[model samples]
Target: MLTQLNHIRARRADLRRDIDVVHSFEAWEESCVPSYCHPNWLAAYVSWIRLFRAAELARTIVPAPARILDFGSSVGELGHLVSEGGAGYDFVESDQHSADYLVSRLPGARRVTLEDAPEGGYDQLFAIDSLEHNENYAELLEVLAGKLAPGGVLILSGPTENRLYRLGRRIAGFDGHYHETTIYAIEAVAERLLARRAVRQVLPVAPLFRISAWARKS
Candidate 1:
């Protein structure tokens, strides 16, 4: 186990050093994929799924048309799952490089554009850690509110500042600046985005330091 972990750590070491944003499809395909480094597939998978825990939780809520969105979908993990039913999967990604990667993974899903996202709109909305990648966290829910069909479901997942996160970062030697925010500390941050009468559900992905929240229109 230790040996395997070491291998993953080495790969992550390379991925951690730079933040030169990937700018285009060509660069993403030719350069990004080659440079894409992940140390542990299991940990990576957990992180990928953590981003969209909201989508899964949304399943418990009822909606119409079931239109879905994978916000900030890197390499398309959520897209791949959505494509299983060939449902309407809208992958909204700002990074052209990662978006391109998502396109390849989700050939059937449509590219969800910000303009196309309607107000009070989608029947089913889900995104993983992708929401945090953007600057306007509050604006995100407002946009989704309009896009959802009435009585729709919204699922979103990300980290909650906790002891597990600290340990994970220490073990992986990766930065946790963005993920360490406590959900309780900023509890109202998301509450402010929601409708007054909606139903909500919450789940914790332990050790992963992940939280998924589900809200249903009233």
Candidate 2:
């Protein structure tokens, strides 16, 4: 895990050098990429570790070499872990710039549209820190769950939105206007469509994020 984290840090540095950090479109601000590559050690550590935790949680259920889809994958940071495990990686990124960057980083990974994501095509589906941004995350979760093959797992992680989480976001300089709901709300809806397998609290001491795994109900 340490080795993987180092590799991610290096790649994040490369991304910072390659991409525009202060763009007018707010894309940079919208992306967690900046946070991952933040010069401030604490900010960067928090952002990168969250993805690490999410991917680590995923590996517990969806072992390597499985067909995987990273929904709303931002520039495909998780693709590093997916590729390392020899999994067939696919991603859906609505932001064209991020999508192009993701392709550049993980050329082997397929880029699929949300509507075109093959149903029952993936053995594992991930929606880390992405679903809560959408008001229709419940409907989106249902559709994403459908893309999973029988016995497949859907791994998720998002802000807890508790006071602690809100405080952290403010400290990090984000108002979190993009988030339509909280991870708690998302999980509540997920329980209706999938059976919960496991749950972990990120930064268990402070408990800012929730990482969960679920499978389609039998």
Candidate 3:
């Protein structure tokens, strides 16, 4: 774990030399992935571990030889992990700076627009900390579900927005103003289009964030 954190810190330093990696949530609302490399342990831990935890769950549920799409993938960190896991990777990043950074780092990983994401192409679709930022998250869920191949999984990770989550956000130096909704609301609509398969909490105690996997309903 220490080795991984060291690697991420080094990578963050290297990336910041040429591009902007958002340190605080206020700087760039769209791309806060860089906060994973933050010096503050609490902030960095909360930011990065969700991806690791989500990826852990994904590996357990998603079959091998997978094609993965990372929705709202900021700077391709999740794409990096997916590629390392031997999956073919694609991503959607609307922020130009983050997209440019993603391209530079993972040139082999294709970048596709959400609308252009091929139907029934991906075995695993990841929407990590991305969906709740949009007001149209419910509609977005429908589109994401459509992109999955038969029996494929959609992995979602988002803030719980409960009091504990709120306190953690404040402690991590992030204001929760950017989010348009909570994970519960997103999951409420997701239930209509997909069936929940697995769920895990970010922390052992408080449900600060949820990492869940779902499959399209028959």
Candidate 4:
């Protein structure tokens, strides 16, 4: 686990350099900066890679030209990537700043909240790194599952049971703010979904830090 964490940190360093080159410092600061910069910017950079991976994996399941809902979308970065593949997306974010940013960045995407999310179903739903933030994640999962079209897929990913990772974050002074609201165990939630037959498969997204479960609603 330590080795894996080190690998992630190294990769994050590389990505940070790439981001610097691709985006002006001011632009990157505005859109990509994290609240805490202590112990480096690992948390922020790692999130960017994770969201990108989640979006890529989601595309494999839903493909292009499908309707998608990005629940708890922070700045809608993943939704923007998925939309590039010709998918229409509705973004649900509780943060008004993030929602406004999404609207500006993704003009075609609809911005809404969970309560106001469009009725009916979507071809694909993404909750990357957002589930852990919800104290009532299980209930939200059930609600999200109900929003999927027949054979539609829900791509969910978040950190799970990584004591070492948590410790590192704590040492880095990020514990106070990072994942403070995460309460659900990924395994338990996955089991509940499986028992209900709401999810046909629960696949881990390589590296034990995060799990991406592909739940298909029948």
RMSD of 2: 1.8
My TM-score estimates for the predictions, one after another, are: 0.66, 0.93, 0.90, 0.68
For model 1 the TM-score comes to 0.66
Best by TM-score: 2
- What do the candidate models score in CA lDDT, each in turn? 0.52, 0.82, 0.80, 0.58
Query: Which whole-number lDDT from 0 to 100 does residue 26 have in model 1?
Result: 38
CA RMSD of all predictions = 7.4, 1.8, 2.3, 7.1
What tens digits encode model 3's per-residue C-alpha lDDT throughout 1-218?
99768766776676567655453445464566546655586777777778878887888877473689999998778776677632488899888778887888887788899888899899889999999999999989999989989878899999899998888777766776779999989888888989899988888776788989998777
Query: If the candidates were sorted by their TM-score against the true structure, best first, what order would they fall in?
Result: 2, 3, 4, 1
By summed lDDT, the worst window of 10 consecutive residues in model 1 runs over: 27-36
Candidate 2: worst-modelled 10 consecutive residues by lDDT: 20-29
Better of 1 and 2 by lDDT: 2
Q: Of 2 and 4, which scores higher on lDDT?
A: 2
**Which residue window of length 10 is worst by lDDT in model 4?**
195-204
Superposed model 2: Cα runs more than 4 Å off: 23-25, 84-87
Give per-residue lDDT, candidate 1, residue 108. 72
lDDT of 2 by residue, 1-218 (tens): 68966886688778877886656336677777767766678777777777777777777887764688999898888788766432489898888888888887777888888799899888778898999999899999889888988878889899888898788778876788999999989999899988999998867787888899998888
Expressed as tens digits, the lDDT of each residue in 1-218 for candidate 1 is 47534644543453444333234323433222322343556546455344334444555565234567666665555554444543677777776666665565456777768687666556667655445544566676567655666676566555554677667656644554444334432235556655433322233336444454445434
Candidate 4 residue-wise lDDT, 58-147, digit = tens: 666656636889887766667646776324788787766657766765788887667776555687787776777656778887777767
lDDT score of model 2?
0.82
Candidate 1 CA-lDDT value:
0.52
Clashing pairs for model 4 are none
